[model samples]
Target chain A: MWARTEEILPYALLLPSLVFLALLILIPMVQALLLAIQADSGEFTTAYLQRMAVDVNFNDAWRNTLLLIVLIVPLQIVLALAMALLVNSRFKGHQWFLYVYAIPLAISDLAAGILWLAVFTERGYLNTAAQGLGIVDQAKVYLSFENFGGLVAAIVIAESWRATAIVMVILVAGLQLIPRDFFEAADLFGANRLRRTLYVVLPLLRPSLQSALIIRTIFAFQTFAVVLALAGRNMPVIAAEAYSWYANNRDAHLAASYALLLLGLTIVFTFVYLRVLGLREAEVKR
Target chain B: MAGIRMQGIVKTFGKTTAIKEISLEVKDGEFLVLLGPSGCGKTTLLRCIAGLETVDAGRIFIGDRDVTDLPPRHRNIAMVFQSYAVFPHMTVRSNIGFGLRMKRVPKPQLERRVQEGAALLALEPFLDRYPAQLSGGQRQRVAVARALVMDAPVLLMDEPLSNLDALLRLQARADLKRLHREVKRTTVYVTHDQVEAMSMGDRIAVMREGVIEQCEPPMQLYTNPASQFVGGFIGSPPMNFLRGRTKAGAFEGEGFSLPMDGSRVEDGRELLLGIRAEQIRFGERGVPARVQVVEPLGATALVTVLVGKVPVKVDAPVNTTVRPDQNVSLAFEPADIRWMDATTGAALAH
Candidate 1:
């Protein structure tokens, strides 16, 4: 009897979480999948998916979302790597620098968007500084409705600034795991600073880089608040279209379809990142 | 193929000084070992020579070049770390050729040199294996091969074999000595194990605190240590010390007395008599003591005898019969006794 209880104990303890997942996550996911393919009369149809495919904003939303991911992910990785290396160097005041670099992680995505918007607004800090320096005669409209490039740049900068701290934290943890002797060996072998970073540090930091890329890309697929705050309706993203379809147009079916597409893109990118950055069996064991 | 010289090197970390104004010369093509206990600054001195640590007020020279201001890479020196810091993601071949690649050596020449290094270390079979796939000893060989392929003028090793098991350490030690003889690179090795120092060093610098107590050939260090610390550090079952004062042309302690040259010291000066365990023997006439313990080994036994209240150890033949509580006399030649000042721990002139 005791042996049976021991065997069943783990599942018994896990029952609450399993039921919670069923009600909150798994059930919603199944309902969303069904709602995306079902009509109000309870008959199967391709009408909602076809409508989502031909929506006026669909192409623009897909294009903008992909462009943001491409521009923002790599930029954030580079910036985070620099920050992690700087903090890892353990300079006189490196602890302070670490806390300062991580400050953005405490901010919300919408708040970060508004923060950058304050700088790029017509009469904000950038224009004020340019005007005060006599570099420009007037305040430039950097986020004007017609300036698609300006809007995209603004959104990219905001998103990168807001999300880079998490990547830096992960990279810093990875950096600390490497022994100091490796760097010393590289130094003694005549590796310059750049060569050491490129060959030694980067190759050893593969696991961390893989994780940071996957996490940032997945979150990037669901990016909505930052773009909504910065570009408003000027730029359309997949997440923003899903929200609009459900809340404004009262079309839950189309919203579910958009969510399914977002999920598919996340899975594809995650798989690609895994395939590219995966460690071999030997590397993982160490 | 180059000698290292440091002049008046001093290094301090915050309130503590790690290396105090010490200078030494290493001969070209010499195997110099820095031996000391932990925190004794031997590794720090080696780092200064390798350009890994900057000396506060000293100039370092590799061969004839003033390399104090040069980075380690510019100094043309290679070092094997204690951790055997082989790149885990790379195969042994790439690791061995990394330095050559950095120098942009021609492909054929780089491959040839890598092959030569692997052959020297018996790593030809493991060339394509990652460090994680190899054993501890194999990874250590990879580290050595990587440094050797650099063909640097100077080689620095910081306890490179200390992590291996005892049997492997012995084998690796012999292998390293043979490799050194063949390459003859000006090498500086740092370790705390006296056995490693004695067996491998052409010359040993014994350090204490932050200063070198004595720097001499291994046999010289064994037979004639300059200070009490060096004598105590360089031997297995270290040198025995007995505190006493000179009285009536004899050295007298708590439980024993031995005749000495009176003219060499004052009649009442306090001193310490140092003797090795192997140097003392059982005899019919000498200091008398009671046996305390007998530890038997294969060919020899360590007999602990109490002279007065102080226990003294003597290496004896294993077949000899002696038990605890038995009485015995310890004898030694007068010339073998080392006299040291009790307070300062410095050897006193005979």
Candidate 2:
């Protein structure tokens, strides 16, 4: 019944979602910023930020988080790329392989942590298998607090297995968007499989790769319940420490600062991904 | 340049046979156009020779090498796709040099060849640009340049100009002919356009339902089509067919009678009378027909006429004053009439 000029229509239609975003997302972010920087007397202060700096758990959590990202993202990208290529090959029953590969996506992060713990903990499936295979003389406590490297390895394996599916799905969609003729042309030009993947598929899949990297990196930064479920008190990641600060220490200020720091790191990494792999608007049009 | 030879090539996809037992040869340094409609196995046959499609049963030879079982990389043949298939991410120079780069050709030679190809296609100005920045015609030229730089003895093109606008198609067609003349590679080009086949091909192979009906030079194929299908498929304002019966030494239709040789014809037997539009002319004494529609095409006009219920088309000069609905006598020489078996649609011996 009402008509509006073309210039005004899009903004008018976007007004409702903008209002919702301002209320739900912006307000919370502002409140967290306030809580993180303000002292108990409600005065602007850096006391909580300094306290967070001095916290023992903060240093360990920061190091563990960085190490986890360093280990997990590349592992996931490589595994996801391999899985995506395997599915793209249209091997026998590839549709079934897609379903099988996506099974991890249905498993929650906490569930995946517990699932792998059953294999990696002392007297767990991995230990029993190693013992049965005569690779290990006896059952060993692989996830102990003292065995920091082994615990990190266990967490890396679990996180990669659980989250690689998301990246794989993104890569598969990107692979499908590339026209078949490009590969055929490459073949006609005497490119073998490795050369085709390196030259044709990878370069064409830049945008998808950028998105997958940014999303996975942010999700890695926010990783919480998985660390808590697998390591309990033995490992303290930023997210897990933020949880402990709020629940155990009853210090929401420190918790908010930790959360803000995680968000900042996510933004920094996302910026890097965009800078390195982003397709120019003109390039995307091609 | 090397000739291409296929021996009883057969290819099937699922339950549908795309190319059925075809054996064809493109002579060395010859321009051979495979002319056929869509789904007529022309593209599949070309792909088979390029090693893109594996044959179920056949042997393909490029020059002296048997390349039937080799991968496309080993076949040493370049193909220009109908879609142009230019790498959108790469510059025109990189695209043109891609085959050479894959072979690890020294950078100097690759650059020289790429430059030569770009100059040949008049793409030197766009050599640094990506395919997306170029127009459709330019993109197709880049594809052609990419193929040319391969310097392979055999080249395959699948309706490469089909994606261009009408005016661009005309120019691209001329460019392709000039390139063929300069390179003299054994080219197997496929198109559904008869005009392209007629103008560009040194020899044209007309295919239908996966089999080649006739393979000959343009004028020979036009003057003597091997079957009713070839006769109907190869011309504009297509060859007209009138259902009738042969009586004694004359062919009789519903409202007309014409004299013909009856040595192989049975008396009072059903037959089809085929005549080209250009062969018929208006005359004072001939079969009487009323004009229906006239389409003036530059130098000539195609006139449609009705002889009782059967429609007939005659090519006339544009200046001729033949108006619609006017009764006129159309004349054709006895030798111009092609007789076909009414039931089988195969050409009947004269």
Docking class of 2: medium
lDDT of 2: 0.90
Candidate 1 segments whose C-alpha is farther than 4 A from its true place: A1-23, A40-46
> Model 2: per-residue lDDT, tens digit, B230-269?
8889888778888889898888988888887887777998
lDDT, candidate 2, at B132: 80
Best by DockQ: 1
TM-score versus the correct structure, for each prediction: 0.95, 0.96
lDDT of 1: 0.91
lDDT of 2 by residue, A44-77 (tens): 9988889999998889999999999999999999
Could you list the CA RMSD of all candidates, in the order they appear?
2.3, 2.0
